[model samples]
Target: MKRDERSIRVLLIEDNPGDALLVEEYLEEYILRPDLKHVERFQKAKPLITDGNENYDIILLDLTLPDISKEQLIENIKHLAVEYPVVILTGYSDLEFAVKSLSMGVSDYLVKDTISSLVLYKSVLYSIERHRFIRSLRESEKRYMDLFQLSPAPMWVYDPETNAILDVNEAAINHYGYSKEEFLGMTQSALCVKDSNEDAAEKIEALGSASDRTIQSHRKKNGTIINVEIINNYIYFKACKRVIVLATDVTEKLAHLEAIELQNKQLREIAWMQSHVVRAPVSRLMGIIDLMKTGELDMAEKEQMLDFIFSSAEELDEIIRDISAKSEEAFSDLNKEK
Candidate 1:
């Protein structure tokens, strides 16, 4: 016969053989198959639990065993089977203790003498399903925690009302140079540079109406300013309103862009000087040469005119050299700092 994947695996800790056989018969009556392991005393059950090889769905305790009985039995079972839902099966039920046991995390309190097959089956099924749901929820929370802590980028969660930081991931601690304890005590405003938090807060609040992504400046723990692209969202967590923040460090990217723009500006200035300032000297030299070619000056005057022409030519050469130096400086200074 093919085994059912949904088959319930149950551990029954009962000292009475008759009661143990009865519980098995009750399980057989149910629609679902239950793999039941019966132990007559707590000692035998202890090793099965401690071995860690066996994974039981639910535990049924008689609350009275030869080696361990009554309150001690409940405590011992709970200590050993932390993940399993514990159902107390006692021949005598004390109403006060039953209520208290349930409050202490016991799944069900059953009176063995009056327990019918249907009631026993239902209780086991219900407790197993409820226990599984709670376990699944814990697993979901762990998955989210792993994603946050193991992320390559910084992330944090904070109280939306007080702006107090609630939790920070490992990535956030490493990137921000702050310990986890220090981060928890600090408020979100501490991270932002003065006057920058306002616009970011407003955008974060707008996330409730619609999503917004913003780039803002923030100061690190060591007072180094950084540019970050922030994306935030409002979430209801643990019965409190909170915001989850994700940031990407873009300080280097912005600096690189600014350098490119500066280089372009310097190049434009050089171009203008080459076209305008150099023309003035060249025009003077042309006019002086024209006078000499027309024989407008005597030999001694021509020597004086040659001096003027030489001066203009030198001025033009200086202008071209300055432009060359400026172009070189612009290119050299643009080396990316990051």
Candidate 2:
């Protein structure tokens, strides 16, 4: 009945009725009134704790039990306790075993003789709180790893001080043609076509968390060059100051822009030919017509002007043909590009 409606649930694995009753009294006297479950041995406790559905706060495990005890007992229960903190209950003389169990993943050890109601209560609450914090930290780390390692774009972390590669994502391995081990052993310069900024280290120090991005050329393993825009962000990870880099390849995009520019230049040249060369002969023809209208030339001069007009017309026709030819060529080139 006490296990049905308490906040801090605990599992007590001890065969001694005296010790089990003492722990139960200590836990119940606390303001929280922790719900306690008592099991005689590790064998019966396995199903109650390891079902994944039961959410016990902590375990009070005695070193001596009927079915399981001591180091092997801790190991057996640890494999079942996904996140529940196990506090070992031992005699004062078993301090060495208690210390070893602490290193083996037990939360904390309590000596049975000295542990009063208040002391036992405090140890249970503290162990639960500490274990909660530990589990939360590990979950945060796993989430960060998932986001970085599973991304589709190439990304890596490098130490700004030494320019050494710290870690790389799966995308980086496939994109750069380097294995994970090889990338870790290399520096940023290995993939760079140019040593762009010798003062990047100083800049990263000055910028701190507010890192900027820049475009540069990078060399691949097969000796091919690619244009990339690299972004930088600083983070303190694993006791090192590192910069997280994201490289986006822009070589094909740049090539497409260059092609568009060349097409624009060709169109400008055609426009110039139309306005300058094609208009030159038309201007001469207009001037000869004006002379004829003003009657400025007699019969012989008018014949000479007529001959000049014919030559101008012939030149204009040639200029029109040239413009048409160039226009056709430009269109053909554009079609090919498409």
Candidate 3:
């Protein structure tokens, strides 16, 4: 039958010719065709094992070799286990040793007397796939650690039960003005400002299973308080459930917003002066001029009306100066921020 999988390359390290032939025949009888390289001595396999010229999916190692001692034989197999999955091919007499080899990193062991084509094929496929999976898991974890350590924003991992900080990144160390050792010895509550601690806890508790994000006041090592937006997610770290946090400082952002609001309030005051206060004096001055133009008053009444007009003019000048001062105050505050 045509095999559905790719051909598996195997290296057989055995001194006995018959045992090597039997293993090859067992694989040939199965539907999975494999490429097998056989060597009779440990010295002959050293070059292939060390040099990267040949890449094999798995190794079928003999429990005994002619040139190497039993202790040295296990040492060699341990080294090979790092590169490829290893299966022990042993006689009945070495069954105990073969079982012990499994603990020394051997993938699987099979007795020469009871081996079948199907069993051999399945062991090869299973060992190779399992090794690939384990290697992939290790690579993924390395990538995650790389990102965590190299992140630009403040990041940390903490245990939720005791609120103890587990791990902290370089950015967090610099931002909080704390050493890594110091951070690890402290709890998350120590970083929070006293006033916000209870409110932050209530918001985190209310989030349930979802990620928690809220703006909070955090105290630094130098007793400087800053506002930060903290976002945390639940994750499994080193087989224990933990929370990972990312904090973004929003202190300057909030200050800028407040300044803009104050400037807006000042501008609103100037607009009120223009619309109501300045208009009142100007309207009075125009009414006094209209009464004088009507010629319905005596000389003394006219003089009194002129005095009222002069008073209204002075009020208008004072209102104009007040509005100009408010406008200057608003722009001056804005310029100082820049």
Candidate 4:
């Protein structure tokens, strides 16, 4: 819906009847006819504003309410500013206090003697718009905070320059075995297990330019080293440059991959033994049997051929045993890995 065409609900708290009438007339002059509700005392206005049943777009408040002291009124206005935009109406005598109240969370202030319809309309409209923008910004920040805290993967924010941990989530605290207070007290490099590739400065530089991921060794509170894939992104958090990190533990995954590769190497060796070692003895037996079947030898020569056959058979039996033993060993290793 269009902003100007929308209805505005305004609550005016003023004791003087003439001043309240002037405000109602000024709001009526605008094309947008605000549903203006007038109350003479601060006590009466409090329940109307705070009851939740009546939602107000903006509040036009007289700085001199009969039931509320100046100091108490200012305090009340500050609390109301969180829920509604408030514009102060005052005489020239209270002009200084009105001006000061603007800093204390009053959206705007206007002197009643010189107030015009145009000025009042602008103040009310502008205050409501500005308050809406501020509320939206706060809500967006809250949603981001929720996502960061509730994520399953370990997440943390750190200062890029000093490498100091700024904030960490519950997952990060649990995974790293550190309390939130301990994590904040330590630098980012404290969690790192220094090794050949401990180039944290260079990695932080890369992270500042763009989102990146790197594999590194990290140590837990218990001194156990773990492999982690860290994904980093640059962010401006709470008006300061920071880097957010998400860590995934890849220790078990990498170990499983290495085991599979070793199993493949063993299987290849077994296949080679079958093709080369097993083939030699089987071929020798075949040649010796063919010679015996020919029956073309004398008694002594036949006995010699028989000896050759017996020797080839023994060799083939030993080769078969070796192949069986190696096949069993390779399978046993694979099963243990699984």
Per-residue C-alpha lDDT of model 1 across residues 168-204, encoded as one tens digit per residue: 9988888889999999999988887743445444544
- Look at candidate 4 and tell me the lDDT of residue 208: 61
RMSD of 1: 5.2
Candidate 4 per-residue lDDT over residues 1-338, each given as its tens digit: 22355689999999999999989888877736578899999999999998999999999999998899999999898999989999999999999999999898889999999899889988998999999998898899889999999999999999989989999999999998999999999888888775323353244334362335576788999888987878888899878989999888867766666566677787788788789987887787788778878878789988887787788778878878887887788778767877
In candidate 4, how many Å is residue 55 off? 1.5
The per-candidate count of clashes, in order, stands at 0, 0, 0, 0
Write the residue-wise lDDT of candidate 2 on 119-225 in tens digits.
88778878888989989988999999888999898999998989899999999999989899989999997778764433432333343423455656788777788
**What lDDT is obtained when candidate 1 is compared to the true structure?**
0.80
CA displacement after TM-score superposition, residue 206 of candidate 1 (Å): 22
- TM-scores for all candidates? 0.78, 0.81, 0.80, 0.82
**lDDT, candidate 1, at 236:** 82
> Any residue pairs clashing in model 4, and if so which?
none
**Looking at model 2, which ten-residue stretch has the lowest summed lDDT?**
198-207
Estimate the TM-score for candidate 1.
0.78
